[model samples]
Target: MQINLKYFASVREALGGGETVSLPAGVATVGAVRAWLIARGEPWASALSEGRALRMACNQRMCEAEAPVSAGDEVAFFPPVTGG
Candidate 1:
């Protein structure tokens, strides 16, 4: 399946901005995607670490790790907000 992926803030810097990529089916959870991304090596591993402050959105709405993903969905990743 293919999904639109967006990276923001520090994550964008870490990931060198963004691109759309194809993800395998059954990677239904945010955690699953994170794990897959980390397996890509280097910056992905560091950028996606659980210890890092991160936030996600699915189809533009804030989402949790357990949020379900579908083919053609848009998923976004970014550092946690610091501004008030």
Candidate 2:
């Protein structure tokens, strides 16, 4: 399955900004995707560590790491919002 991943703020900085990646079909949750990304080495590892305070959105709606993912979904990752 292919997913469009958008990274923002601190997450973007850590990942050198956003990118799209093709994932295997069994990567069905946000947590699984994060784990797959971390396997890519430095940038991914630091950006998606378990201690990071990250937020996510699926198809434009806020979601948790346990949220389900499907083919062609758009998932976004970012730090906690600070603006008013």
Candidate 3:
């Protein structure tokens, strides 16, 4: 399945905004996608690292890593927001 990924804020700066990714036959979840990207090493490994505090959304709805993902779905990753 092909998925559209969107990065925001610092995540975007680190991962180069967004791009399309293809997943081989298997159950692909939000967390799985992240892990896949992190496997790319370097900036991807660090930016989407499990140690990082990042928020996610699927099809415009906030969701956890375990959220189910489907082809053509738009997944977004962004850091938690803070205001003064």
- Residue-level lDDT of model 2, residues 2-71, one tens digit each, is 8889888888777756677899767899888888888888978898887888888998999988999988
The residue-by-residue lDDT of candidate 1 on 1-84, one tens digit each, is: 887788898898888667777887768887788778888898889988878879999889999989987888888899878877
> Lowest summed-lDDT stretch of 10 residues in model 2?
11-20
lDDT: the better of candidates 1 and 3:
3
Q: For every model shown, what is its TM-score relative to the native structure?
A: 0.89, 0.88, 0.94
Which runs in model 1 stand beyond 4 Å of their true positions? none
- Model 3 agreement with the true structure over 27-79: per-residue lDDT tens digits: 48899888888988988899999999999999999999999999999999999
Best by lDDT: 3
What clash pairs does model 2 have? none
Q: Clashing pairs in model 1?
A: none
Off by over 4 Å in 3: none
Better of 1 and 3 by TM-score: 3
Clashes of each: 0, 0, 0
